[model samples]
Target chain A: MTSAPPATPVPAGVRATARIRATADGRGGTALPLLTGEGPLALRRTRGEGAEAGVMLVGAMSAPLGGDHLAVEADVGAGARLALATAAATLALPGRGGAPARYDVRLTLEGDAALRWLPEPLVSVRGSDLRVRTRAELAPGARLLLREEQVLGRAGEPGGLLRSRLTVTRAGRPLLDQELACGPGAPAGWDGPAGLAGHRSLGQLLVVDPAFEKAPAAAAVLGEFAAVTPLAGPAVLVTALAPDALRLRELLDAARRTYGW
Target chain B: MASSLAALLVLADGRFPAGGHAHSGGAEAACAAGRIHDAATLAEFCRGRLHTAGLVAAGLAAAAALGLDPAELDAAADARTPSPALRTAGRRLGRQLMRAARATWPAPELDALAAAFPRGAHQPVVLGLTARAAGLGPLDAAHVAAYESVGGPATATVRLLGLDPFEASGVLARLAPELDAVAAEAAAAARRARTEGTEALPAASSPLLEIAAEIHADWPVRLFAS
Candidate 1:
């Protein structure tokens, strides 16, 4: 029988280390701070009157549940760059206004990774923007499943919004860099004809599943959402527009079900 | 004033070709879905979007063009766009316009702006860069910026709805007085720079058009990229 690893206790005065593990929604996430030659990450968090500035060097990870948070600040050291960022990621924000509230985040994924970081949408209005700037250097036979999403506003409230930006580069070249800001007023922002198409929330699933990549025959199944365009490379994007965050999540999950993530 | 008029003419020239054909300004997909059917409705849609997305983008561009510091303008516009696709398209359009403007007329600031926003800058930023490059004053730049932005999509509707060119020009001609009025306000905005909280718009609601634009990403075949 496998025993679950214990949760690392939060240390005082902006510091903590070792292999970090966290969970939310019954799913556990782990982030290894020391990247091969990258060395140890540093996190600095300063709490003030109404705001807090936290920066992570080499950085760290956070539990996806709203009740838990991992904040830090640190300048990163340079090293050999890779392609995909495969660190298990789970983030969350618990409303603390005593009534209800919302959060917005901009997460950047930079540095070395496997192929290109294309996460399925994992947005929520306890909001988080998982911005990533990654340089992918894959060694072949490596698998990647990137789920990205924006959950708008508080579920109980009639109005809520979330915005996110993510960028992935490979071999010092841009592969996929996207900034998504979706909320209640989003549909009306463009006076656009296809403006949000009447949906308050959205999710996208990016799959580099070996089966889909190797077969090449699955082209027909994948061709519907992706094409050879000068922008965004030929990666399939299965997205859903819905009024509720859960509904959008459901749609994205269903789409990825076929990929076997 | 003559400089302003010339600036307006230059900026409003749809034929100038800044890759304008690639984007419908949200009109193509909207019209395809039957959300924006006619001129009045389109105008209504424009006013609403101008207040939210359009106003934010233009405001940022105007602020930058007026010499308020490019970094501030970038942040202001970045704060306003809550939609990733729209922002991305805005940057693409801005880049295309910068490339086209530079090829036709080389301006140092325009070149700098192109460098600053290598990946993408909003449309207004490109206009301000070009206007400044053309030696147009801030007010002059503002007039050109507001008018061209409106004109580009208006022209699209003409082809989309079979509205005659003369008829379309007539509508625009009729809109000249209103344009002048709007241009005056935009010129004022160019003087100091605007924050994300402030916006200029004619009040109207077009929920359908906005929704259509959001859902356009799902469409199987798209004529215009944006």
Candidate 2:
């Protein structure tokens, strides 16, 4: 009989991997889950009331200074539902050789599955170079709600550098594929009228559910600070930038509460 | 060298009448937001954009000049431009550039792109294909893309901030060396892309520029389209 490999210590600075799967219970609901990982990567699932029941946090596998490589692969089976969140703000610090830290997330949603990735802000302190790439594939009727917030640096301090790329697809067509690269000189253009218009913090939220209506209203209300762009599918991309992280957080949280996705 | 370089000059010329005059590359918004107050800040802004968006666009143009697939390059451009407003402006610029290039150069690939996009493709993709039609190489395409990346904004700033046109020109001149380096790197990447695929192209981005472009789009009255 085949068996899972025994756990081993993951060296520092090495990539820690996590895979979580949520399958249909078949009796009429989604199953609990099957999760595996070691090191800085870890997963915590919570059984709350109704929609909050499937919320989970996939975070760093181990404790390290910085420059930890972590991968999270999440699969939500048909008719399954999962709301994913980050345990805390990811603090990116200076690496050993000045190399940036990295995080890679891959999510696949089967037919009729839903995943809400509402992670907290990823704060990049001075001298911190961080890169995050998130790729998601959705079945014909699957749904995904994802958000990414970046704080250039701590309050009153300049941010280091951050490069983030997000690619989302349904069936074989591209719904939304976006990349953002910012660094030490971020405030120059971003703080300008043509760029973030002087905003330091930026937030990107993408929703692919057909039934999600609160976005349109919320987007319309946010006006200048936020702009909503509709995709080919029922999806919509809302991007917002603020002068500080607190304002950006408030803008995003307001949308989150209003949309309730 | 003179003939090919001259053809590139014409394409990169601000007065080429390709609708480039309508867009400021987010400079108008930046100026109004007080991000660019003088020649020094303007230079800094241009330099910042040069390495990020300029580099990315130059790489794509070079790749396109190398005869990479238009659809694939278009998708790459789309992936790089997160702001929907910027995407629309890019295609609009592409359509305008297409009209001029078809009239001036006349290439089968350009025709194919016009047919496929009907609406339009991304600006960098069209720029590369236009360079091919103009008998220019990848380096020339990269130079054109890199130059336009700052040229448009510099001119727009001149008009928006009323900064001295000569000073703005000076900023562009100061950025020339870096622009050359970016174009060279873009050309190198394009050559590599011939074998390594479009993923070899740079995806450097400016999130502030992107987010600002979206906000600028919603302005009830704005001088530039994006």
Candidate 1 overall lDDT versus native: 0.46
Please give, as one word, the docking class of candidate 1. Answer: incorrect
Worst 10 residues of 2 chain A by lDDT: A212-221
| Residue B201 Cα positional deviation in candidate 2, in Å, after optimal superposition | 3.4
Off by over 4 Å in 2: A1-12, A48-55, A58-64, A155-157, A184-199, A210-224, A257-260, B1-3, B188-200
Best by DockQ: 2
lDDT of 1 by residue, B1-226 (tens): 3455665576667777787766767677657757568766566545444443444344555565666666445544543332346557777888888888898779777777778879867777777767767766666655565566556567777778776677656656766665555556555655543432222211112223333444565567877666
User: Candidate 1: where is the Cα deviation over 4 Å?
Assistant: A1-145, A151-157, A163-194, A206-239, A243-261, B1-5, B13-23, B38-128, B137-149, B162-226
Q: What value does DockQ give for candidate 2?
A: 0.35
User: Which predicted model would earn the best TM-score?
Assistant: 2
Each candidate's clash count: 66, 14
State what share of the real interface contacts each candidate retains: 0.12, 0.27
Residue-level lDDT of model 2, residues A46-150, one tens digit each, is 674453336456555322235677778889988887877777877777766555678888999999898888887888788777778888999888888888898
